[model samples]
Target: MKLDLIEPNAHYDMAHGKPAVLEYDNDGSWLYRLNIEPEMGIPEGQQEETQIGWKCYEVRGYNKATKENVKKVVIRSVIDETAEFDLVNSYNKHVLGIAVNESAVEEYKEYLQFTEDLDAVLIEDLSN
Candidate 1:
């Protein structure tokens, strides 16, 4: 599958806890696994905003078929989209056993679902 075909926010199975592998290609030459990764951090120029964080949705290509490998190197490309810092920080805080407001929780949930949907579309496109 072409890495550029992946959308900005791909939908995935949240119930599964992690983004599912969208595609795997082994054509005797190389192995490729495509999937979305949600990461937390402030972007380079936005580092001064301490209360803010970002949930970066990246389409990562791995050399291995599974993520269980000790050194999972990305061999293809990474397409990323950055969201509001508060939304990501809320999600991160919740994961880190911190308390967030009700609205923050809902916002983060919505963001996650949106990204998952994006993934679902990419997976379908690759299959076709």
Candidate 2:
């Protein structure tokens, strides 16, 4: 029920004022890619837009000691009293910007299906 999310190795594109970046390991290994977004909440007055903000989000990465990627959305580490389900908030870019453990991707997919209002989820291939 409760899963832990991994943070990325590093970030970039922080020059002026851009969305915070979550970098990944580039050692030519298999890494799970996930395209995620918030369930819904475009605000009542704002016109529908395509981009997402970077204020709230999380990425799952390995801790080095284990050298394993975290493929599932962390079920814990959430304490929002008003949220419908436990979640890892992240920008729902039109891209697969988040990475998880290769094995946990499926588990994350299954878990996401049960949750409503979330943005469309996409799983990326490691070979790519």
Q: What do the candidate models score in CA lDDT, each in turn?
A: 0.45, 0.34
TM-scores, all candidates, are 0.31, 0.24
Give candidates' CA RMSD values in order. 16.2, 15.4
Q: Report the C-alpha lDDT of model 1 over 1-128, residue by residue, as the tens digit.
A: 23334444543333444533444446422332344455344656885433222222344444443333311233123212344566677777877778656777777777566556545544563454
Q: Give one digit per residue, the lDDT tens place, for model 2 in 1-128.
A: 22224333322222423332233557532233233222333645787753332223454555431212333332222333334232332222212556434445444455565332122222222323
lDDT of 2 at 34: 33
- lDDT (Cα) of model 2: 0.34
Off by over 4 Å in 1: 1-82, 94-99
Clashes by residue pair, model 1: 10-115, 10-118, 10-119, 11-115, 11-116, 11-117, 11-118, 11-119, 12-116
